[model samples]
Target: MLRRIVTFVIAVLILGALAWALWPRPLAVETVAIGKRDITVTVEEEGKARIREVYTVSSPIAGQTLRIDRHAGDAVAKGEAVVSIRPVAPGLLDARLRRAAEAAAASARAGVDLAAADVKQAEAQLTYLRTELSRAERLASQGTISESALDKARLAVDTGAANLDSTKASLSVRERELERAEAALIETAVSDSTCCTDLKSPVSGRILRVLAESEQVVQAGTPLLTIGNPADIEVAADILSHDVTEIRPGSAAVIGNWGGPPLAARVRRIEPSAITKTSALGIEEQRVPVILELASPPPQGLGDGFRVVVSITVWQGHDVLAVPVAALFRQGDAWSVYRNVNGVAKRQDVTLGRRNNDDAEVLSGLTEGDSVVLHPSDDIQDGTSIASTSGAQ
Candidate 1:
């Protein structure tokens, strides 16, 4: 009876093992068929939306910042006043200049008066000298006047001419002084009145930053504000130097997350210098900065310094054999895919060319109708069986 029982147990165990080994199994899987499609190779980088023109309003002369007309994000017009500053004191240099001008004017008036008096005295002397000379000439012609008397008359005429010349010189000096004083007064008055000047905007744009406030004292060359236009913008993105080889001017780009829908962009320029940047992964990366010009008008609410996500298209091809990136596995330096054939997984070595984030270009070893496993596991080996729920096992 014991022998029979043991034999029965052994038989049952063997049958159960055989049944488990031959049982049909199901696989949790996602798969896609290979096909000819478009493929694009791209490099993605984070950037910021910045205006094409940024004008920094700086103090033209040293003074106190009296008032600010606009704040950050305020709209400004060309030739509009943005800030007004007043000097600590009416320009001392200008004040001294005014006083000097007043003194010069007073002196000029005094000289004019003196010149007029001299002119009067010269006219009186000339008249007396002419009368005396005439009398002496008449007397000499009558032979009653001496030769000495005639000589004296000639001397008097010459002296009168010298006196007139001296007076004319004095008058000329006075006139020049008056002209100089008038010019000086005008200049001084203008300077004193302009001790407070209203600063104006140099361009039409929105205010980006305001660095001054009312009643604040500012030094020479201090920056007061910044303004820029958002409608015209440029996106500067840094690309890894390794990936920059395929990127050139005129490449296409897509910008996102900049307070608007994705905007189309085009590469306008490539920086000549490369910069070293540390990535978030703690790796030192050599990056080249590329400048992109927006191809369309920016949407509303977009402003300067807005962060954006950029995808630069380095290369693209149409009607190319493409495969999902998950379907590929790296074997040493080459690529391979696990294709489903007759309910069995067949490992086929493949040659891949350009690859993007989601797909890769299949250069060889893939047919248009072949279905490949996405993310095949190690449990799936050559000739391993698979059961597709909708189709076959």
Candidate 2:
């Protein structure tokens, strides 16, 4: 009787061990506590720095451009000669043309001589008018002539002076015509010689590019170099058209990933036009450019066309309840998070206000110091047992 009783107790103990082994256990997960802090919503995009004002130096007249000694990034001062160009000499004229030029020059010279004679005649008349006016004044003072006669003499002198002044102007015009005629007659001798016309720099800045470097004959208004002040640099970023509505002038921004610490900046303008661009994924996107002005001087090594990453703060709040984005998921039309209630995962519907890439602002349905499961899997459900593990907030 004692052996049978002991055998039954052993069987019961074995069954209890098997039942415990087969029992379901709690799922291990990562959890973080909700907290209050500042949260900022931003839009990040790639940008490039460029000079605010770029000036292109072009040839003023059609001529040969000399070799440029200054290269890209060379500093230049205002009015400093950057390029020297010599005008091409005129082609040699035929005999008939030469004779005609000579004849035109002779006629111009004759005109000059005729003008000189007229000037002399006018000078003589002016002298005579002055003498007559002086005599008339003296006679009138002495009462030797009537007042009407004195007035007549003064009028005559004034008329003569006017005529003399007109003749002098005609003489000057004739002389200028003669000089032009002489210039036309003097043919420019063409030779393998260098006559440089120095073109001065329009503004003080660094050379951005050299369009024409070698000795070449370029037409009038041909671009020679590009210049701009690197210190006056601004960042240009293209943002998707749909995302641009939230951005406004004077919006705060931060520039980073430019090989140094992030720099502070602000939005200065938003372009009115939109540009269609093919993205890397082969999708067409409409983008608008936003201009950013740096709040401080850029660090060393930052120059025009330098690549940078820009983050524009569209919304921000201080001392706001927030949680990691991983803790939240879409539950039908509402957002939901798994809260840790006494080691049990509890589904809680949450109202979200603003969110960024990392964190989301909790408007309601969450409180500070509340532990919540991060990246909860499908196994986690209401009243499901859960064990906390190390994870990022």
Candidate 3:
């Protein structure tokens, strides 16, 4: 009877050990507690800095532009000469052309001489008119001549003076023609002459580019260089057309990842039109250009065409109830999270508001200090035993 009782005790002990070994254990997971903090919703995109206004310097007239002495990035003052050009000499004329030019010059000289003679004649006529007017006044006062006769004399003098003035104008025109004829006859000789037309800078700024650096003949309106103020820099970000609706003028922004600390900026304008471009992934996209003005001077090394990352603040709230986005997942039609209650996982339905890349604003269901499982696994179910890696049971 004693041996049978000892066997029953050993069998009961083995059964209890088996049951303990097979019992379900708590699954380890990462969790975060609901907290109150400032949540900012931002649209992140890459962009570039550019001058607010780029002025292109162009040749004002056709001439031989001299070699440019200044290079790109050189500072220039307003009204300072940036380029120098000399008028090209006229092409060589043949014998017949030379004779024609000489004749034209002679004719012009004769016209000038005639003009001088006409001026003298006009002066003499004016003087005679003055004398005649004086005589007429005296006659009218003494009643020695009819009033109409005196008036007729005055009119004759005025007509003579007008004729003389007309002749003088014709002579001046002829003199200009003579000069043109003489210039045509003279052959232009190319030489290193100091006389040149200097092109001045329109604004005080740095040279952005040197379009023409070598000596060459340029026509009027040919672009020579570009200039812009480095301090007046702005950012241009290309955003998808769909995302443009959320942005507005005067929106706050942060410019970063440009080799220095982030800079504060604001949206100045949104282009009214959309442009089509092929993305690097070989996809066609419609993008709209948004202009951003920096709130302060850009950090050193930031200049025109410098690449940067921009985060535009679309929405923000202070001291709002929020949670890590990883904790939230779709449960049926509403958003839900695996809330840790004591040592078990409980499925809690949550209403979400504005969300950024990392955090989401919690509207209902979850309260401050509540722990929720981050990236809950498929195997985790309501009422499942769980433990948080962050010490939350």
Candidate 4:
């Protein structure tokens, strides 16, 4: 009887050990509790800092500009002489340029002669048409010609007069062209210092850039240097057109990644126009310019065309329930999350509002203080046992 009892006890102990070994355990997961906080949705884009009013100095006449003595960041007062240009002397002018000028003058003179000939021809035609009209009127009164013939003659005279006026206008235009061409032949005095024309800054600012650093012959309107007030700066960002709709003029903005503390700014305007640009992936994107004025003075060393990142707030809320974006996953057609419920993983479908790079706003199906899995894996299912979590097995 004692041997039989021992065998039964040992068999029961073995059965219990096997059962314990085979029983399923909980899956370990990272979990986070839903929290309420202030949330803001923003659109970020690369931007540049630029001066509001930049003045470009250019050669007023075709001449040789002296080597630029000024460098970037050189301060210049308004009316200060920035550079000088020596007007090209008539004898020193390029042979081709002189020849071109002579050719242009000759062409203008020929055009004037042609226009005068046209005017004289029109006058002669008018005289002939008037004579014809008088004869037709007499013949019509004498019943030798129909009134239609007289009317035709009258129309011819009217048309001839109009042609004469048009020819006169053309002649006037040709005359003006000849005058302009002759004026171009007038020699500028090159015997004295007066020949060197000093160009002055039109605004009070520092030289922002020196476009032409060395002495060179430049045509009229060739840029020499750029001037602007460095302190008066603004930021320009090109945002996707579809995303710009949420950005309004006067919207609050933050300027970052500019090698200094983030600067506060306000959107001065959103350009009405949008430019089409190709993204790095070769996707066509419609980008619009957004100008933001610095709410405070920009930090030192920030200047024109310096790169920065801008974040424009489009939406904001107070005391909003939010969750980590990684916690949510696609379940059927809606978003779902594994909510930790009393040591069990419960599948809960959630409604999401605005989302950014890190977090998502929960609109429904979840409340504050609820625990949810951070990165729920495939092994986790509804009612699955979970461990290493606050509300887990």
Candidate 5:
């Protein structure tokens, strides 16, 4: 009888201990106090710094770049000569080509001069013909010449008149030839000027690139140097296509790593075209280029093509009521949070709005000064008992 009573009591104690072990208990959580603060949605991007206006200096004529005054990073002002070009020893057909070009040019000039002379000669002939015709008519009228003789005089007058007309026509043709010759002369002179021609900067800026080395032969239109104003700098950053819809002109930005401190900026323009850029994940992303104008000019040391870090502000709110994003929970399209009231957890459905960085805008259901659970778990249910510690409320 004694053993049976002892076994029964022991079995009851074990059953009670097992039940206690399996029972639910209060969950520990992190909490955040709701308040108002400024939040901004930023898109981080890496871009290369570039001058506002870059002018590529090219050879105006085919020649050798014989002189260069300044190299890259050299400061230059307007009308400053940066490079000089001199004609190289003429090409394979240099002599013959030169002679032909010179001949063509001379012929054109002569043609022009001849046209002017012909015009003068034609005017004189016309005047003389008019005088002779008048004399012939007067003689016929006075009967000093017979009818056939008068007729002969009239024919001579007609021949003179025809000659005058032919001279005038020749003058017109020669005038056109003169224009052609002048063009030919210019072309030949440009190709064979042994004297050096200076290439000057059109604007006050710094040299960004040097395409020509000393004593290098170059053809017309070959770029020699690039110069631009470094004071007026702009950042061109590419943003993902999906994120582009949220960006617009006049958006705020923070520019950094242009060899100096962070600078404020604003979006000036957004390129309408989209380009494909391969991401590290091997996904092809459609990106749109955006131009951000720096609010403050960089220091003098900054040069063109320098790398920069840009953060474009896509959305912003100031002095608005917000809550920590960790405190919010999403269910379908709705968001909710666990509000700690008198050491008990209560579920409050919240209407959430624009969020940025670490904070989110609370539209309703939660008021300022309310404490909400941060990163609440599924086990924290409605009307649940809770304990408040320094770390967890």
Candidate 6:
């Protein structure tokens, strides 16, 4: 029985050794070597090209504006007549109004007649007063009348002359009132001139739009057209509030997707406030307008409201030691990655610095030339054995 038991135990040991050697093991894993590279972090989003300044022309007075002689995209010069406005015609009077106007005109004529009669009476009285004054002076010199009486006569003559002048001025006022009342009786009429008032462009630019296309009566301050210079253009981007905090005026940027070569640009302005916008995923976000100016002249065919893509540089580094972002995994409160150590995987907790979509800045727990396994699986552990799959640095 002892000999049989020893023989069976030796056979069992051989079978166990064979099974361990032939068992399949997971050792092949893709990894990348850590190295120094130049990295630039940017916030990219869709944007549009637009004119820097837009000018709106409005009517200066209430009148009938003539039909616009210019079309959109037409060039215009300063002090050029862009719009012509004629005086608005007077409205037609109804039968009742016509009678009232006639009555008023008759009353004004009667007033003028009465004033003219008063003037004639005053003139005659002034003539009589002058003759009396001459008689008084002669009597005073000949000693036929008292000097005090002659002085009173002379004062009456002076007062009569002043009354005559006042009467003539009253007649003139009544005559103007009659003329105004008669004008109201006319069936249709226009303000003073047959000529039109030409509204000129204040600045030289192309016509962007014609708000008023046909002849129409417009009030003062009504917008007639829009003008802007196409050559003076800029890019506008509505960026997320969180992303815009890192972008300041004068930051470098690149504009693309404009149907031409990418253009270099720089941030010129960031709006002071943010507005609520609904995203494509139905999420509400705060968006801020960021204006970027082209570093060079805009490419041909790039005009206002053209769609483009803007990549604004936020942070950049030279000679940065970075680890593949795919290799990073969350471990409780810290980040962890599996570094390759002589075909063995050793897990290490890492403290990271600035990170992007593809790589992260290494701040601790790593060294240059170290290789880390990418997309580590659940089977990977603190001391998992692994072999290089394909990728290098």
Q: Whose lDDT is greatest here? A: 6
lDDT of 5 at 28: 74
Model 1's alpha-carbon lDDT is: 0.83
* TM-score, cand. 4 vs. native: 0.72
TM-score of 5: 0.70
Worst 10 residues of 3 by lDDT: 186-195
Model 1 residue 87 CA deviation in Å: 2.1
Estimated TM-score per prediction? Answer: 0.68, 0.73, 0.71, 0.72, 0.70, 0.74
Q: What is the lDDT of residue 106 in candidate 4?
A: 97
Write candidate 3's Cα lDDT for 1-393 as tens digits: 899999999999999999899988899888877799898999888999999999999998888999998999999999999999987765789899888888988988888888889888888888898799889989999999999989888898889889888988888888888889888777867677546999999999999999999999998999999999999999999998988899999999999998999999999999999999899999999999999999998676899999999899989989999888888899899999998899899999999999997889989999999999998999899999997777322
The parts of candidate 6 lying over 4 Å away from their true place are 1-24, 56-89, 114-172, 187-206, 210-225, 281-286, 376-387, 390-393
Selected candidate, larger TM-score, 1 vs 6: 6
| Model 2 TM-score, 2 decimals | 0.73
Mind giving the per-residue lDDT tens digits that candidate 4 earns over 204-264?
Answer: 9899899999998899999999999999999999999999999999899999998889999
Could you tell which candidate, 2 or 4, scores higher by TM-score? Answer: 2
Task: Please give, for residues 1-393, the per-residue lDDT of candidate 5 as tens digits.
Answer: 999999999999999999999987667777777888887878888877778889999999887887576788789999988888886654344667768877876787787677678768767876776777778788888988778876776687677678777777877787777667555445333444457888999899888888776778898999999998889788888888888898889988988877777889889999999999999999998999988887877777666678888898887788888988888888667888888998789988898788866788888898888988887888788888766443321
Q: Candidate 1, which segments miss by more than 4 Å at Cα?
A: 1-18, 21-28, 90-194, 389-393
The pairs that clash in candidate 6 are none
**For candidate 6, lDDT tens digit of each residue in 1-393?**
999999999999999999999986758899988888877889999999998899999998889988998999999998899999997876799889989999999999999999999999999999999999999899889999998999899899989989999999999999999999998887777755676999888888899999998999999999999889888999999999999999989999999999999899999999999989899999999999999999998877898889999999999988988888899999999999998998899998988887788889988999998889999999899888888775756
Give candidate 4 regions above 4 Å deviation: 1-22, 91-194, 390-393
Clashing pairs in 1: none
Looking at candidate 1, what is the lDDT of residue 82? 79
Residues 189-297 of candidate 2: C-alpha lDDT, one tens digit per residue: 6566767788988899999999999999988899999999989989999999988999999999999998888999999999999999999999999999999999997
Q: Which has the better lDDT: candidate 4, or candidate 5? A: 4
Query: Pairs clashing in candidate 3?
Result: none
Error of 5 at 105 (Å): 14
